[model samples]
Target chain A: MKFSRKTLGIPYGVFLTLFVVAPMIVLFYYAFTNGQGVFTLRNLTDFFTDPNTLGTLFYSLAIALTTTVVCLLIAYPVAYILATSKLKAKSVIIMIFVTPMWINFSLRITALKEILTLIEGNLAYYPFLNSVLGMTYDFLPFMILPIYNTIVKLDHSLTEAARDLGANERGAFLKVTVPLSLPGVVSGISMVFLPAMTNYVVLDMLYNSTYIMGSLIGSYFAAYNWHGGSMIALVLLGIICVFTLLTDSGEDDARTGGALL
Target chain B: MKKFRRILVPVLVLLFLYVPILMLALYSFTDSTQIGAIRSFTFKNYETLFTTDELRSMIVGTLLLALGSAVLATLLGTLGAVGAFYSKKRTSSIMSTVNQIPVINADVVTGFSLCILLVVVFGIPKDTYIPLVIGHVTLCAPFVYLSVIPKLKQMDPALYEAALDLGAKPRTALMKVVIPQILSGMVTGFMLAITLSLDDYFIATYTKPATFDTISTYVVNATKGSQTDIKTALWALSTLIFVLVIVLVLVMNLNSKKREQKEAKA
Candidate 1:
């Protein structure tokens, strides 16, 4: 007996539609409806109007943005050095940075929490700071990996060409290397920022507070406030979609710029 | 100055990464009752962890979920990848885009939304391993799908055609010629799925039954109100996991290197 490739894809299509697409539909249904299942926009309105909820959204965005910036500042230099260095054990060193990831991140964060406590004595007094540090620590590798991948795959002659064109080392790096690596930086920012926005474990572990969008959703779910939780999640889904679209447009710009070059 | 910085920066970053983990590992061996104070070195944390009921169940439950999800995801995903590879171009493109939803969506949203589906929409009871496994499979299968599709693209089209021309059945041609070509991708996908599933906390937390607990959720629960003993036991578990991973990675690297050398000689 023979089976067509389209037939082979049927099982997967069914699985995806049932599990992924259907569940999302359910999420939206819950987001818009009240306890009686009547359609309503109150959930959405309540989310935007509630000061605490709005504050949590702001906090989530602020912290995620800061974490992205910190990760970029730290990771760019590290990834640059790793990519350009003549070190013999470069792969081994890169592996070192990656291996900690295999260890459960929550465990790493817990270890970090312990160290922070020992250093400062009162992490509670600095919840935002601790959460930022934890977010940066937890996500720095994510930022590094994408940027490293791009930098390593970069055309060496691009830099050489810039230098050949009478550009100094600093100018060559700033003009050529930075532009070429923008895609990776953009991707790294998206990866880090999206997760950091929803990462309640780091916040909960560091601050024991539900101050971010993720923590807020988690608390609502924990309390069986399904309507509230789903609404927040839907809003987050919209935000993430817009965020990805913006970053993806930047990537398109980079691609066009590279093509022009 | 440049030479000094190249070494110094990496060393500093590495220290930042490893110091806490090493310290935690060190603390795991010590009798640390208070949060920051280690009094004496001992193996009691491990001993207690090994004997405890809740911790034992948590470990078993975690492994069960990880393994079950990894295996199921790999099977479904490999099939999906194969299907995608041979399907029409337009259909394949659409499938691939839809598949990335879970990968890009926030973990919190995925977990919460799925929880809604299982509990409210489907009316499945909350807090069972079934939902957790299903949730994890959903999370992991996409990774396998993405990984395997690339290998399939890279495979030689002639191999399968040749097998078919040699009078092999379609299934035989697929199993014999195509599967072997994509075995590495499948293996990579399986490993990736396991790692992703094992490290997950958010999806597991929302999807899991109240009685069930993965290592992540257990640690989170223990850390609530700062249960020192449970936290230390987790550190011991972390040390064990860290050592196992290091050993496994090293062995894999060595084996691959040996294989490469053999290939070069041939």
Candidate 2:
């Protein structure tokens, strides 16, 4: 039997529609409807009006932003070193960065928690710091990989040209290397920021606090308050969609040039 | 001094990365069940992990779910890539854009949305295993799709035409010409799907039925209420996985190096 390559996508198309598009619609439907299945904006409005809910959203954003910034600062130098180094086994070095992820994620966090508890013994009391450290630890690899990809692809002559034109080494690095690697920086930021906001597992394990948006949504769902959960999730989806568009619209070509891994 | 700084930076970063892991590895052999205190060293936790039914099942469940979803995702994604390769520009573009949603979308939203779809719209019983599988597939297929498409694009388009011109059937041409060219990408996609599925806690927790427990969910739940000691066993598991990953990475690097040397000589 001959299979038409054109028709090959039909099954995935159907699957995508049923599983991907339809589920998002279900979330929206639940977001708009109350327990009685009647149309109401109460869930959305109540979420916005409630200080605690608003607080969690803001806190989540703040924590995720901090994590992204910290990851960038730490990863940029390491990635720069990896990319520009004359090492023959650089891919092996990159693999070392990625290998940590092969261990179970939550278990890694659990281990980190144990180490922190040993050192400070008060991370339980300091939720914010604990969560930030955990987030940075988990997301640092994500930041490094993309920036490393971009740096590896960067033309060395650009920096050389800058130096020839009388710019100093630091200046060339700042103006040439940093600016050219912006796409990877952007991808890394998004990779870290997006997940950091939604990862309640780290928050739960490290701080046992439900102060972040992820924990709030999780608790609502756990309590069978589907409407409330769906509403928050919808808002999160909207925020992320807008965020992605803002970050990616201008950098599409440059990013596709760099390997995402 | 310059060379020292270069080596020192990498050394420090690697140490930062591994110290906690090393601590966990050390504690994995400890006889203590308490979370904060480590007293004696023993292999009891490792032994307990093998004997414990719940722990053993969690490991098996996580692996099977990852493997199963990786296989399904790779198959569907390969088909989708080929289909999109041949599709009209507008349709392919739309599919590609839609594909990015799962990659960038927050796991919570994706998980919650799927949960709503399964429990609310379809009225699928919550305890059934089907939703977990479906949810994992949805999570994984996009990664495979993304990885495979580049490989498909990189292929010489005329290879397919030549196969067809030689009087081969479309399926024969695809299996012989197209599949081999994209096999590396498919393998990469399969591995990616497995890793993504393996590390997934949010989606698994949301969609998994009451009867099933993945390693992620099991680990999280283990620490939830009163069972902190179960963590020592989890430490043993992490150490085992970490060591295995190191070995795997080394083997892969060696294989690639050998292949590269052979190609150079050839």
Candidate 3:
């Protein structure tokens, strides 16, 4: 629909301005300014001094990494299965994986904690494994979808060509399918990796924050430490921006490039 | 022989992927009744969920969160899609990419940042619905934008041109002509957003007011409480939701088949 420039520009301008752009500027500004409204580096310095806050950055990353590796290991086979098999009801399998994902994420995590508690006393019964499993269950979809998409797109002829050569079954898969599905691997792992590293909610829900980064921020907020919270977010945002820049995951292009469509 | 291996590998993978969810649903039924000797049969757990006031309220709250976020997300997403459509600059590409990040970003990180957005920067009181909605919408709107923008891009300029030529107002053209063509895409985005909003947890924990709760939270709380009735209800409820989702998906698939048949006939 054609319209006056104002009609077209004004509405979205307000939205982006108010919601996206404005808050971002305010957050960065809030990070620098103190309670008296003068500029200071205290918040940034304080972020570094607190072991709990600073330590969470790594804790968060470790969680994401652990989840990514596990998810990739599990998802790759499933992706390959979906890509290779002519099984009836492929959509059914897909639906089952996605169904829980559609239910309340918080609820699933909540349920997970319940299940863990029943399985053992509390996750304290098996702290490390519990956290990993918690992450694995929740973020499995992120790892699966992109890899599945990638596996589906892999050139099947390559596997055939590899077989025609002297390569054994394992070699053919390793040399052909794995390499060919690199984009999906790249995309899927990238999807899994970044979020896994940043995620602390699963850790919070399943474990008692015995060792987690996200929980620190949660507690800080709970304690009414706005200045410290903004500083933490600003730091995380900077790290994310850099990571996005380096990987150039092209996720934006893929989604809008008619991947899901 | 190679083909057989291919078939075997995929079947195993399918089993692996689909097993945990099925198991979770199964265990939910048995959690309470099968007390000793591996008691695997009973609906007592499900009974507790339905009977408990807290569980009932949580279910309602989760449904409300999903519904509210999905509606707001779909509306904002449509606007973002429209904005993306009109965007001739490289900025749309960047925005779309940035928009896509939250969908894949660690929920914990987004929840953390959103906490900052609401409780810290805006001085929004902690443990309120506003933060909950904002957290959900931030995550959900991008999916809607991703879903709707492509359809909007594919619209025929001629249809719009004709409407304008016939003296239809800009708003009318968008409402009557543009929306019809893009309705399916919009619907897809809305469904996605609904699911996403429903799926949220990380944000709920952070932003949810101290006393506030949801289906997910209740399950977690109950597990921590006694590992009994409330937990089973959550399982039944999650199963119910899954069943409903499966049915809805089947219906949509059938509807799409019918549409394709009609199109082919036409």
Candidate 4:
């Protein structure tokens, strides 16, 4: 009897069906159903109509946006410096920056909360600032690693050729290096943005704030409102799907010679 | 001046990254009940960490869970990668796309939905640790699949065929020829799975038994309450974990560097 290689995937396929696919189906079912389990679109309408939910959604978006921008701003320069620098032991330095991720993040956030309280006398006073700061601190390494990997693998000769073709240093960097590194930038943005939108732990530790989308879902589940919680989860899943599609298409466009100068 | 700027920027960022961790390490050794004040220099926190039964049990339980979940994820992930690598293009593409769902989805959603599916719908009791393990494996297996697929791509596609042509059984060919080539990728995937399990808070919070706690869940809950002794001891645990990770990563990096140098010489 011949053993087919295709049989090897059966266990994983079964696992995925039971865990990933079914849970998503269950989420959709609950989202469209009320407590009595009757099918209704009330959850959807309620999500959009409730001013508090709408406020939380938009506020979460704004916070996620701020965190991603701040992380990119800090991480790009750091990654660029580490990748392009001629210094020996640069990998060790990069390792130092990334190693904090291994420590349980709650502990680090707790430590950061202490430092903030010392400086401001009260973390509750600066909820937004502290939230962004904590998130930027947490997600900076995610942004740095991908960008560094991309930038380091970039062909140096391309930039040199641009310089040879009468392009100045700034022009070569802007036209060649930046455009070539967009894949990394986009990936970094996606990695940081979605998590920042949902990592209510940061807000919880730093500000005791629960206005974010993640904690909103938590509060719903805590109140035994599975229907409401599932709806929010479904909405978040939709946002993630759309965001992923947009970024993916953007990457495809960049790859097909759509470099912007 | 340009060189100075390059060095200065990374240095500043590194300071930003390390300061909080260093602060935590510093506070761990002191007798201070909080971060701002240093009442006395002592090793009391470290003592508390090892001596407390609850802390010890939680730490041990977390490590055991990480190991168990990582092992399961690696098996499923490697098998999926191998099967997909050998399958038809359409089937492989579908598998890959389905695999990406968990990777791209938020952890909060994944945890919540898993809780609903297994506990609420399927009627699995949460205390059995079944749902927790399944949740982690689901979170981790997609990543393992991703890492292993690249390794499969890098391997010589003809090697397996040659083994079979030489009269090796299909299982033999896979175990002897294919698995050896992807061992490094499997190891990487296993390590990643462990870290993901250890770092997870949301999934564990949603699915873990009411009496049990991983370090992540324990830290979140412990910090909320005013258990100053347990909270302070966590600082010690954090310091220890930080040191352990530093040593592990540095040694791995050095070994890889050595391997690269040997390859260059050869």
Weakest 10 consecutive residues of candidate 3 chain B by summed lDDT? B31-40
Best by lDDT: 4
Model 4 chain B weakest 10-residue run by lDDT: B31-40
lDDT of 4 by residue, A1-261 (tens): 468999898888888888999999999999999989899999999999999999999989989999999999999999888888887987777777778777788878878877888789988887999999999988888888777877888999999999999999999989998899888899888888999999998888886575889998899978878999999999999999999997873332221111110
Q: Once superposed on the true structure, which residue ranges of model 1 sit more than 4 Å away at CA? A: A208-210, A249-261, B34-38
Model-by-model DockQ, in order: 0.49, 0.66, 0.34, 0.53
As for candidate 1, its clashing pairs are B127-B209, B127-B210, B128-B209
Error of 3 at B37 (Å): 5.5
Q: Which candidate number has the best TM-score?
A: 4
Q: Candidate 3 lDDT, tens digit per residue, A215-259?
A: 655666668666666677677777767766666665654443222
On DockQ, the stronger of 1 and 2 is: 2
Sorted on TM-score, best first, the list reads 4, 2, 1, 3
Q: What tens digits encode model 4's per-residue C-alpha lDDT throughout B144-208?
A: 88778878999998999999999999999999999999998788778888988999999998899
- lDDT order, best first, reads 4, 2, 1, 3
lDDT of 1 at B263: 100
Judge candidate 1 at residue B195 and give its lDDT: 83
The lDDT for every candidate, in the order shown, is 0.84, 0.84, 0.68, 0.87
TM-score of each: 0.95, 0.96, 0.84, 0.96
Q: Which candidate is the best by DockQ?
A: 2
What TM-score does chain B alone reach in each candidate, compared with the true chain B? 0.96, 0.95, 0.88, 0.98
Task: For residues B90-134, write the lDDT of model 2, one tens digit per residue.
Answer: 989988887777777888888888888987678897677778888
Alpha-carbon error at B14 in model 2, in Å? 1.7
